[model samples]
Target: MALSVGDATLAALAGVAIRRKPARSGAVHRTGAPVLRDSVEAGTFEEAFFAVPAKGETDRLLHVARKTLDAARRLRRDARLGAKILTTSERVIARLTGSAVRVYEEILTLARLNRGRVFPSYDYLADATGLGRATIGRALAILEAIGFLVRQRRFNRVAGQGPGPRYEQTSNAYRPLLPERVLSYLPRWLRPAPLPEDEVQRYADREADTRYMLKSLSCRELAEATVSGSLGKILAKLGAAVDRREREAQIDPQPLTDSYNKAQTVLA
Candidate 1:
């Protein structure tokens, strides 16, 4: 079976190769036409090397790869991809020194490229990134604690059969979180607005003033108050409407008002 150009592109974008299993590796996986030969003497079926993807599987893989690339590209072009978030995040991250930044950069790369799902072992990352495993651990810890990243430890329940104890350690997935809840983590300049130091006192004072005004003022006066609170705004609208009607009455007296007075006299 020939590999398509789209499949090749997906393989490159995924940073992983999809190749035909070696002739002697183990049991072969079968898709429609038995791409893999079931070996009688081999280990469990799961241990079989994944054979080259069938046409349908390859099509699906390519579709997913294209979609992921499109999503990543769209994210880059987002209108909110402004300097403010980057500036704020950098100011906060500047406190850290050393390999943490390198590890973080690598994690960010993986997360952005894979849509927040990175599944590379420590050794793979170390080799690909040229950073010590211990440094990676420290960086991940700091990022996770600071809410800049989320780490999920995955355990490889099934181990591949090898000469030694099947090394069953799975890589941790690192997801980089966007600049959410920036106020707590960023500096005052980066935040939209800082709460006043006497915020609680100010709230108390406002509450007291609101209660006193509500108790002392008539509905019309309350509505017409200078303060722009929700209650005052509503009342002001009602008062304005009533005042407009009264002024119109003073201009030329309502015919309905005179008619009602005449009716009352007839009733009496």
Candidate 2:
């Protein structure tokens, strides 16, 4: 099939190499070595190709994406779209090709299943969208370039375990975004909500509490103080358990030597 203008734009935005096959060279034949494909391959996108996004940025993006997804879902059900006139969200959806819409809808469905977090693998997306992995990649690139999605590369920490690499690439984390241009067309209810004032205060309070508990008080002082909440009880119990373990260690300072002595006594 011919590549659409939108697909070309998406390819450029994603840095995807969408080109015709290069001509075989006589020098390559003389070398007699296999020519490796440098283009992006399905399921071969590894962690080393991209840096992991910051946790705070991912969190912020995911929050906005969640709101956008919610609004998109609600907009789909609006009766205005069924009529000759289209709602803003409907118009946005209409702009995408039918195949692109299918791929996008499948992604949104998966995100909804994961509580607005897109955690599915490319294979999973292919199975869900009934499209090849390459096609899905192109579709994702399109959505991301249009400011309708944010794709973050993620990795699993192997921690020097029996492995070739310390970290391995995992499925990307996708967050849907509301394009800035489209935001003007959306109604107040359909638009992404601002962060609540209390959320900031609550986060600050939590940080302050953590700092006070961790830095202000020493271990002994914290253990001895009679704190009023469940957190206090948990800490107190943990301290007691640790103390008991230390005392037990002290009681049997040389367990191996003591065991050897007891064995000699029994033999004697």
- Top candidate (lDDT): 2
lDDT of 2 by residue, 5-56 (tens): 9988988898966653432332332123323322122233333233344434
Task: Give me the overall lDDT of model 2.
Answer: 0.59
lDDT of 1 by residue, 1-268 (tens): 5779999889889988676443333544332112222212112121222122233432332233233334334434442565233444444443343455556666655655654456577787788678888876776775565455555543333434544322232455555543343334334433335478699789999999989878887557766555343445777878878877877789988698889999999999
- For model 1, the stretches where C-alpha displacement exceeds 4 angstroms are 1-95, 159-167, 179-268
TM-score of each: 0.31, 0.35
Question: Model-by-model lDDT, in order?
Answer: 0.52, 0.59
**Which residue pairs of candidate 2 clash?**
none
Which stretches of candidate 2 lie above 4 Å from their native place? 1-95, 158-165, 185-268
TM-score, candidate number 2: 0.35
1 in model 2: Cα distance from truth in Å? 40
Alpha-carbon error at 235 in model 1, in Å? 55
